[model samples]
Target: MGREFIAYIPGQKDINGQFTKANLGRTLGLLKKLLKGGLYEFGTLTAAYNGWAKGSPEYDQWMAEVAVYPTTAQNVIRDAVVNALTHVKGSNDDPIPLTIVWEGGPEGVTSRYEAAGPSWTVTITGYPPPAKSMLAERRDKKPS
Candidate 1:
């Protein structure tokens, strides 16, 4: 069976330090692509796929709601991602920093993962993405 999970991408701020419509749109678009692919990996971990909650009205509702209000939608998404991550044997350890990418522009956010009952969820808190050096260190050094 495919594992189910939700990924929350925070809206990037504009020049006035506000989350404008464009930022929200980009975040939503990224989320949509993530959901459609249904798979991801962190660091050296093998690939993992998202699971389906199967006949869950709340799950269905939450999925529908995420695109409209990113902030309010975090809790629901966190539940799903946590549930899915639980199925994996190991954790990413440094989930937030590790997930951030430093290519082109900044995809800034701190990811918070939580697991409860049969749900897995992740929340993306707005922050700067990792610096190039930090990412390089993460890639070069072994976990201690």
Candidate 2:
């Protein structure tokens, strides 16, 4: 099976207290570009919420599953994914908090990009093995 990751963008509100569509559009556009390489496919966008307590601002957080070809190198995929998500900026050109959970599992590496840092911080776990090409798999399976 191919590898997949979950990308998350925390809901952001503008000065008028409305969820900013521009931010969402910009992020989606970047992701679309990343998919142009033919190695990635973006899943449907899902609405997620946070801070459900009383008087807490509730907004629409967007989550999407990005699937990558199993033959691609892990580091290459990670860099491309992180680069695309981290480039998304708010209306005021501020960094937006974004996250990607590699392999779409609890045990996968969870990389987070916060406004407080200039790079993605892996707060979860270690990296998975580099994917092997179909040809390589077949070659290895051949009688030695």
Instruction: Point to the candidate with the largest lDDT.
Output: 2
**Candidate 2 residue-wise lDDT at 31:** 43
TM-score of each: 0.19, 0.23
Residues 87-106, model 1: lDDT tens digits: 33355321111122222433
> Cα deviation of 100 in candidate 1 (Å)?
14
Q: Give the Å error, residue 1, model 2.
A: 15
Q: What is the C-alpha RMSD of each candidate to the true structure, in Å?
A: 18.6, 16.4
Task: Supply the TM-score for candidate 1.
Answer: 0.19
- What does the lDDT come to for candidate 1? 0.30
